[model samples]
Target: MSSDQVKNEIRRFLKSDDKLALCLRGKWGVGKTYTWDALLAEAFGNDTVSPQKYAYVSLFGLETLSDVRKSVFEHTVGAASFRETKDLEATFSSISERVAQLASKWRAGIGIIRGVPVVADYGGLVEAGFLDVRDQIVCFDDLERMSDGLDLKDVLGLISFLKEKKRCKVVLLLNSDALKEQDADDFRVQLEKVIDINLEYDPTSAEAIEIAIPNRSTLRSRLVAEYATTLGITNLRTVFKSLRICERLEEVLKGYDERVISQAFHSACLFAFALYQPNDAPPLETILKNRPYSDLFGNKEEKTPEQIQHAELLRRYRFLKVDGLDLVVFNSIRTGVYADELIKREADLIAAQLDLNDKDAAFTKAWDIYHDSFDDNGEEFAQALKQSIAENAVAISPSNLSASIATLKQLGHGEGTNDIIAAYIGSRGEGKEFWVGDPILPRFNVEDPDVKAAFASKAAEFADNRTLEEVATSIVRQSGWDNSDLDYLDQKTAEDFYKAIKEAKGEQLRLLVYGLTYFRNVGNPDPRMSSITTKAIEALQRLGRESEINRLRVSKFGVEVPAA
Candidate 1:
């Protein structure tokens, strides 16, 4: 039922003198209890509802009927008093008055000592207090989570007793889907005897968002609701969690532009759902990969149901990829701890880039030629793209620059692809190392061979500039080396290797020799390994033969120091 329909049903139940029990059932975390409580608060404020006393007890860990009965007595309260002060003090006073009244009625069961009644058992008094719990609206929640020791049949019997015997209005809230098979069967058998009305509390995405984020006037809440609706997230708990994350983002990004806030909010909504509702949303790893549209073409593999759903969700949200700011939002959601300074740092960078993009409206429009229309503006867009690349190529990220290059090449603008690559490379000074750890080209999907060759040339140039000391330090720092690092080492001659070892002393010399010996000990896995290890072994032998102290130091390593 819709939330409004459920509310009306509940209002009718409260207004009518129907002592029958109402069962509000739905999936877990769908706000069954939240909706019930909201309706109760409204009912408490209104004078049309008949019941003035209320009790809400969770059967989550209650193991027996007696435990449930004690809980009901403990939680009972007057609606008028609770609405006014929102405290249970009045309930305690009322319970005390009832207990005194019942104690007089049961005085004969107690033995009198020194003219005072001596009550040996308090269970009877508790039962008496519970017996006074009639004519009130009582809600039992989490019936599915009741302990195994508690029988479903017994709980249902108690609900029947509340409705038929005590003359109280009873409401049972549970996730029927969460019941075990046997329990479900048992509940079905017993539900007919106790429950007079059953309402399925499934709210739509908009209804749930209304229940979760009541004040949707704010931009943050509106964005959260928009993305949540797009993602079809109807779980109010997940919506509330997403809203909390957005609130944190808003607090950290208080003075930022709306566009910046909008980006963060959208990312926060997606990542929050991924974090809290993994079954309904994509996994965190998938989100972190930031490749929503990857592998769309050039592949013939069948997509799984989950993949198809995720693709649709990503398409609807227009979530092409995650950027630096999204990573910050993701970390905040995953860790549940916000680094205010880190968030602000990322937000500030995004704000600056947004401002830059705004100033370069032509650059933005150039991309819109591909995304915003199917018109024959190909020539106009191509010219604009090249112009933008010439002007703002330095500001664009490598991946985005490569995408633009690919787009240009697709439009028969292949002649200018090399110039764009050169401009981008020139903007990044030679001092900056384009290649680190590996020589593999970035998977930017740039199809032009010249662009790839340019990148390879840049990587090789960076590798060639590495001094032996820098290379050895890098090897030791990483504890190993890849083929590229070995390839760099392979370029050196035996005499050059000897010079590198000769320049080091003490621990540095030992560590450098040890790092090189790793390749030698590994049986030369790479073809360059043979030359590099042979040259390193020759260099170590040369160092050992130079002096008696060097011979002792090199011998301590247990490496074979061949004679010169």
Candidate 2:
């Protein structure tokens, strides 16, 4: 039933004096207990319910019938006292008075003296305490989590007794799907005898979000609610977690544009759901490693079930893109440690890029040829595209640049592609740092051969201009090398390698030595790697002859060096 329908039923159950048990059932973490408690609080405050007393007990660790009896007595409170105050001492005093009255009555009936002990043992106290449970409203929750020693038949028998023998109103809260197969069968057989009304408490996604985040006046809360509903997240626990993550992100992203905050909130919602509800969302490793578009269109081999599900989720939600800021959000959720400065730094960069995009409105509109309409405006689009490239080539990302070049070629404006490429390359400042290790070329997707040749030529110029020390320093700082670094190493002579090694000392020397010889330690070195290894060892051997410490350090590589 919907939340409103279930709540109306609960209100009716509260007003009637019928001696029957009601069962509220749902999946785990769907707010079964939360809903029941909120309704009870409302009923007590409004003075519209029939019951004068209330008792709520969770059967989580209760092992015996005696434990259940004691807990119900302890948790019971009068209606006025529930609305007036939540003082545990006052509630316990009321229960103590009732127990003393019951003990005195038993003593008088047995003709025992006033000073004599009426209760002989703890079992006597337990029985007398349970006598106060009659004619009051009681709720039993977490029935599936009760100890294995407590049999289902016995618990059901207790509920039946509360209704038929004691004349009390009883409510049971449980997650039936969480029970084991045999126990579930046994529960079904026994439940029919005791329960009069069984309400399935399955709230919709929006309804669940309303319960989880009631105060959605803030921008962060509204965005979280919006995306969570779009993703169809019905688990109230997951929604609560997502809200908490977004709250932290809001604090970290203070003083930023609303658009930046919205983007971060989107990432926070997806990452929080993925962490808490792995079955419904993709795995964190998959999300962190794969680009959404690549996952959708780049697979040539057969797709796995997980990949298919991920693609469908992305397509359904229209979350077909991600960026560096998303990675910051994912790490914050996974590690529970938000690097506030780093987050603000990323947000500031995004804010600047967004402002730039806003200023280049015509540049954005130029792409409308593909999206806005299809009225055969090829000539018009070509002129607009060429003008936009000329005006905003510096601001265009590599992927968008590739798309623009490809689009211009399609419109028979092939000659303009070179000018666009030149403008883009010229805007990149005069340094080799732009063409450093591992540029993401796959995302470029440029099909034009001339454009490809331009990028390759620029890369070669940068690589050739780089000195050996610059290459070694880059490798040492990152603690890893790429193919370009290996090619640079391949071009150097042994004397060049030795001179570079001879000029270095201390930690830099150690790191450079390790960087050069890393492949040798891993074994099955490539031929280029083996040649580099040979040259590096020869350099180290020459250096080792200068000092005993150097010889000792070189000996660790399984090479003995003679002292000078």
Candidate 3:
């Protein structure tokens, strides 16, 4: 049974005033030790059980045999001399003398002891008369680790003896992985036949706490957005081996559980996307644990600098929405952020802080709030961003640079100047300030993204439920051009693409037609493709023009983990 069920069985058996024994078996790293530690703590604190009456032990490491005998003698007699610890007394005369001494103790014990020796610490406790024989609980751990391998006869004797006790509970705990699969089966079979109750580990609650739940509903989305943003700059791509990276991060940042550990593993895969972001990359030298906080307006709690940066990235991306407020990100490469909503929210906050008039007062104080100590190297780090904008891109919005930068850094992916600028700007959005320079970037001949959109729509249709030929035929029909002028498109390739569009029949032919159409609608997508050529017609034939290329490159090398 599962851990919870085992705990339940233990609870039920306890009501009978029986000595309870529970066996917990599982692989070592699967959380056996961790679960038991938690269960023991919770069990003893339960109102129904008296803590002093129960104890736990590992059979393999109890103590010297000599110490065991001494303890047994003391407990049984209420007090026993060190000299009387063993009937053998180091130098026994013979077996006859030992038997006689043992009989003498039974006689002396009969009058002094009120109850039979039914309860014991271990199997050896039977000889010491410590077994209460009626009501008690004994938990044994690591019994498999005992020096002398346990024999079948000995196990049978122990089970039969416990059954005879009738009112005792026996608990056994094992790390399943430590044993061979063969021996494990036999042990489990034996345990299941005798155990009255069983339990398994419950780490979900603990794992939840480690990730800081309850507060998560408010912050998890924002956190994920920021994480995703970082992945962009770092060029995170979908790859299988990334599992280990994420797993370790989760263990370091949160805690471990089967579910949480699994997520940590996947997170590493997901972060590959963030790792390859084109702009605002994570600090190259420092670990995420040491990264600085980027959020100027955030909780001043004991959070790492990276966390603050994460929060700021969320705000810039609009991944986080302020309740009861309309937010907008405006750019001004010269000045800084401009938020219509924040201006209103903070306008009042500033007026209230300064105790200004209610009329034009809010705006009057808002101006001071906007420019308040806005300098380089301040806690907000406002000046650093402002400087970058002043030097390169414009700070188009006073709203939330963090969110804008985050979005641009994630989406504005390219190579060289155009790519760096695109990634930087795309983090914010495809807004007007982010227009491509004519020389470095070419404009799509088609005003509408319809050509590319049509390809995706049909591709989805085919993927869901359609034959390849049907999809090919459908695409060919849609991609056929009705006009001949072709406008400013690359002359030679455009004519040939139009000719190919006329002759195509199957999937490959359809793909070429689609590629040409997409080029007509969207600029060259692959950064690597630029080195190949920019000819509108011929670029369609370029290899590896997939939009996923930028992300894949970034992921492989993590040059960009967007921080904005």
- Model 2: per-residue Cα lDDT over 245-303, one tens digit each: 88899899988999999999888888888888887787767666656556357667778
Ranked candidates (lDDT, high to low)? 2, 1, 3
Q: What's the count of clashing pairs in each model shown? A: 0, 0, 94
RMSD of each: 11.5, 12.2, 23.0
Candidate number of the best TM-score: 2
lDDT of 2: 0.79
Which tens-of-lDDT digit does each residue in 185-239 have in candidate 3?
7766776667655555433323323222223342233344344433332111222
Model 1: colliding residue pairs: none
Candidate 3 Cα errors over 4 Å, as ranges: 1-6, 27-47, 50-52, 61-134, 152-160, 200-564
Give the local distance difference test score of model 3. Answer: 0.38
The total of clashing pairs for model 1 equals 0
Clashes of 2: 0
Measured on C-alpha atoms, candidate 1 has an lDDT of 0.77
The C-alpha TM-scores of every prediction are 0.63, 0.64, 0.32
* Candidate 2 residue 417 C-alpha distance from true site, Å: 23
